[model samples]
Target chain A: MDNVSQEDYLTAIYRNLDEAGEIKPNLLASKLEISNAAVTDMLRKLSRDGFVDYQKYKGIKLTGEGELYAKNMLRRHRIWEVFLHQTLGMPWDKVHDEAEKLEHSSSDEIINLLEEFLEYPEVDPHGYPIPDKNGKIKKSKTVVAITELNENDTAKVIRVNDDVKNLLSYVTKIGISLGKEIIVKDKLEYDGSVLMMIDRKEVNISNKIASNIFVEKIK
Target chain B: MDNVSQEDYLTAIYRNLDEAGEIKPNLLASKLEISNAAVTDMLRKLSRDGFVDYQKYKGIKLTGEGELYAKNMLRRHRIWEVFLHQTLGMPWDKVHDEAEKLEHSSSDEIINLLEEFLEYPEVDPHGYPIPDKNGKIKKSKTVVAITELNENDTAKVIRVNDDVKNLLSYVTKIGISLGKEIIVKDKLEYDGSVLMMIDRKEVNISNKIASNIFVEKIK
Candidate 1:
């Protein structure tokens, strides 16, 4: 595709397919914030271009070519995020937006050099696995939402599902980050808020926020 | 301007206006490698947008807003070049094309961060002055083409006027770069070639190549 919007659609479709095994036009529209008509038009074009297999009522599936394109885009995006956050010392919360802009412009040579320069990082600042040059993403260990953890269970913050700046900033302010050790002190039944101990400091996180944080059991 | 082509046109206009006092449609067309009709169309659009003062036959000039926009794009382009060459260790010959792609995508915040990260560099990798945030550029000392220096005169390489990859790569291979010390040894009248001493080694550069290099006299 000649434009970034087309790339965005391919990436969105790949992500939806990866997560849900299929993509619906209405779902794609909602995800892209575009109208159903626009989605249908794009789907037709993509199908004609052999990037997708689309049927009138059946869900959409990415063709092999589309999957490769999406994976490459993802690799560029995550690598840029790592460069901004790790090498440049930018705050993790602020890197996503910058990476989004940079990914579309990065050439293969640039990405290759960047991958080497960053010492071949496996994951981005948000703990999302980065795809290799060949679009191979190493599967990560199983992780569960913090809200799924039992009271008094200790876990390590493996990833944050939500990369929203405000949420990241809030978590950072409360001294919570990837690899941080947290103990679930209590789960309030009244409001679904979870009381946790981070670095011996007690903090209460709303269930919504808790659900967005993925953690791995320590023991 | 909403797109890169428009921004490119504005920057080209600004550069032409800065180098020469005026710009003609044909000159701009050649500079941008586009047709005269395309240049005329864009100039009209820019004129409508109040970014340029375009007359039917006389010439075109950038308005204050247009100059500012051009300066910003130039600033982003040079800063990215510096980042690619200095921070990423990319060869100078390879940075220009990469910077061209990156400049359009860099946001104000990213540029600002990059400027700070680079410790507020005054010039790009090619020794061209980088515009400040307010579009202010610090002018360098007076310089002249290398061919202008008399025999036995010492000078410091200040800038390379030509940025063509092959030319840059050749110069780089010959150990010619910004701030390099050289002494004029002889001028061959046969082909207008100049003999010079660089790092205690004698080298001969053609007049064409010599003219592309600007140097400041070493007093």
Candidate 2:
């Protein structure tokens, strides 16, 4: 659909699936803060517009065209986030809100120029893959649970899926970033607290926090 | 009015007054591609909103609040233009349309971040001054007409008011840019043509072309 609302719905669907694999109408409705009927109405419209494949109550999947459009928006969002952080020195936690507003308004010219200006960045400040102009995403091969790490095993932090602003700021304050490595030294099962050496400094992280951290294990 | 249309009208008025001292409703109508009556309707709404002062049968002027908002938009527009050019490597002539779309979409945070990213740039890609974030514009001190130059006069190219893409690209292709200095060797007044020395090489410029070039006088 040519309407902005339709585009927003498509983008929301893409984002939800990107973060959570599959999407439910109730989940989409809650995320958009709209009624389930509204989501159903738009889903039908999207399906009719050939942007989505819908199986009645089976939820929604993006058609090829829809997926490309969604990925474009995602690329724009992540690029802006990187610009905000790298160029403007914005804190990573605060760039997402700005990116959210900028992504929808960018034209293709700006997007292309940004790609060139930033030197065709593969990931955003938060370590999320930035799709290429043709909607081709570079798959990130790193996935490790902090809880599974043995002593002396090392991995670099990749991304944290949580949206808590305080948590992001806290992580940054602790000197950990997307490419920084941490070696697990000890794990206490009773308290679920893990001790690790990060940047050659000892630190303690709780189990709840450990699960939120995703890393790429060192070869 | 709390409408985007009112914002556009106010911005247009401010831009016109900035370039020229006063703005007429017909000019606004022509620029916006809307009817005079529609502009009148919106002008009344803007007056009611305290953003403009209107008089019947005469053009409207911005009130303080209106001018403030307009200047903010102008600042954002120019700053985004710089980002698209310096950081993104966009051609100078191609930045305006993208900046126009982005200016309205940017938040204060994003604009400020961009300003810092570009190290608080003073001028846009097209050599126009970018108003500071607080809407304080840097006044240009030098103005020279290229057509008025005599033989042996050295001058620096400064600002070009016109934004026609073909002309800009053509001028840029000739290795002429803002602040490039040239010494006039001969002025053939018969054809309004001039032979100028640039970078130790002589170049002939047509009268029509020479008249459009604005420069700064050398000491």
Candidate 3:
């Protein structure tokens, strides 16, 4: 609780729970790049502090208090990312790391003021919805990955998963960003690559990269 | 080294050494609101770590490396204060505490970028010169406390010591801020109060408050 690594662990657990509905110690150790023994020690401590429900053999789950804390951290992180991207003109690829550092030190007052300063942005530059002060996030429906779309279908880019900086830079270089209209011209069966028309220019994207982009179909 | 308390100790030592050319353990203990024993223990550790030249009977002095580290911390703290007051429109009285929290988490890259964003301000909102990245500070000459000026003397406000929030709020309410021109009208000999004219209006300030405001005589 005194260091950023502890916060990272809690957030990682929250993310895993959100994505997969459960957390395994081995998976957490890999995610954090720490050894399994170290992860066990931390999990034991977190369990003792009532931040996690952890059993030696069973998996892990966040308690109510733990979920609230993780959600607040996420809120701070996304708000800062938005500030860096929109206000400071930082590249979307560059905002995540800076926001990660700033989030640990931001107080509730600063976060609220920043939220007001940014005029209550609903999502970050990468299109991830920011959690509200009360830890409630508005779920987005009717959005599917670009890789799921059929050939000749057109869609409007909604969000891009920002887990990789290189992918974001690549996407930005190719003019694939939020609100851009893209048409799937063809899907190569040989390598799973896709040919798309963005801004009236044809571009090729690998299936891996295409899956990271979420879009809403254009009527 | 991992927590803000450690940074606070180093900066406090640097400030004392800069102001008085020496530091006593008891004085440092009082300044930090810790016990003498705790101060001694921390000093011993700092000495062993080569950050301070601590002797059994004599006082302590920062090593060259320690001085640099402390200066960097000061630079970050002052920069954040300037950002909070100037950019965020936070009340000057409320900036110091927020800056204290932010300085620890700010990385070197962020500080440099922020300095650019702020147009490389030489001084913080309180008028204290911010140290450069190399830990070099420009010393201001011809500045003296308002209490030292005689009646009928006019001076331009330079900087106010920002250690006390109530004093900062009171000065702001009285329209005394950086670059304001003030003329001393009268000095109350019995209680050491001074009546001054600011913005074409007269205001009285206590001797203690006057001592904290530095100003340069208007030739």
Tell me, by TM-score, which candidate is best: 1
Query: How well does chain A score by TM in each candidate?
Result: 0.90, 0.82, 0.91
Candidates in order, TM-scores: namely 0.86, 0.75, 0.80
Error of 2 at A88 (Å): 2.0
Error of 3 at A32 (Å): 2.8
RMSD of 2: 5.4
TM-score of chain B of each: 0.90, 0.78, 0.91
DockQ of 1: 0.60
Q: Which lDDT tens digits does candidate 1 get at residues B26-68?
A: 9889888889999988888899999998889977888899989
Model 1 clashing residue pairs (backbone): none
Ranking by DockQ: 1, 2, 3
Residue A57 lDDT (model 3): 81
Better of 1 and 3 by TM-score: 1
- The C-alpha local distance difference test score for the whole of candidate 1 amounts to 0.88
In candidate 1 the C-alpha lDDT for residue B14 amounts to: 79
Which rank order by TM-score, best down to worst? 1, 3, 2
Model 2: CAPRI class? medium
> Which candidate, 2 or 3, would have the higher lDDT against the true structure?
3
